[model samples]
Target: MKRDKDALTLTRRIGVFGGTFDPIHIGHLVAAQNAMHAAALDQVLFVVANQPWQKEGTREVTDPKLRLLVVSQVLRTIPGLEPSDIEIQRGGLSYSIDTLNELRASHPNDELFLVVGADAASQMPTWERAEELSTLARLVIVNRYGYPTISSILDFDQPILAEMPWLDISSTDLRERVRDHRPLQFLLPETAIEAIELYQLYRNRENG
Candidate 1:
């Protein structure tokens, strides 16, 4: 697929993949890559959330700097994977609507696609400024474990939803496996797993 150019003459067929990315893992990369190919995206921006409203005060995330470093390292091996600090620099409750709006302003002529897991997609109606968000970009939902009815959540004709293969792996599961001293050889990207072990993250947190 040919990439659309931005006002600055840069490639602009970008896909936005936002998440805590407390520790970037294989599952996250898999979904992003799959969506990139399936949607014919030229670039995929991995937006690491500084603070996620969904897990507000309930979960402890690794420092944004560390998270950003890990994300950068993980994406270094994957072509077309770019790490974005939009949410981290904004600092506060990171809302999808706000991020999409910012992207729209930055790339006015480019088309934006938001990639999210099925569980989050199922709860789109309850999101802040959800209706406005639907108009901001197309939502590409990836099926994950525990969220089987993703197709039923589309109440509007906007925010086109496309289904992809289900990836059962999750950061929560990776954390638990680490805490239990279990092997995570295939569960996450080698670089990501190395970073997790080096940082010793998610060892004390309970499974989500």
Candidate 2:
């Protein structure tokens, strides 16, 4: 039977995985899968942030449209996962507070689980409207191999630590590899790699 794309509206437990997704990699998928299983989420929303406020001016990211396309393409290969254009549509720098608020408004009765890396969780105290995050959605801190298990850093009391294997792949390193013409082999989805090569993405930082 064919699954309905709009069925996310009826979900009870949602996992919001927001990222630049410079190009959706396997690590992103593994982490989301771990979070979904650990939290028993109804579905995971892979939101592509238009402008990552944290990385702003520090590094270069692929064009928003290309990033979104890559994320959307990989998402279709998996069930129980969907790509969201909430931040891209909203425009400007993406903020967790804003995304959570919008989702809460749309899914008032459903429970929202916001997925974050351990590093991101550590800086929650300084986020815009940080205190209100717990009210908007339960935070799930995904574990990394080197980073300490650190959900308690925030005063919010509800952040749960998801102890999952750390997939050492990162977008920054991935981009560097692309610039160096390194083999992407198993790092990212085959289709995504083909698209990147076909379009010559990341070969030139500014253009990428």
Give the 10-residue window scoring lowest on summed lDDT in candidate 1.
Answer: 1-10
lDDT string for model 1 (85-131, tens) is: 99988999888889999999998777788887777787788888887
In model 1, which regions exceed 4 Å deviation?
1-11, 144-149, 152-163, 204-208
Prediction 2 global C-alpha lDDT: 0.84
RMSD of each: 2.9, 4.3
Estimate the overall C-alpha local distance difference test score of candidate 1: 0.79
Task: Spell out the clash pairs found in candidate 1.
Answer: none
Backbone clash total for model 2 is 0
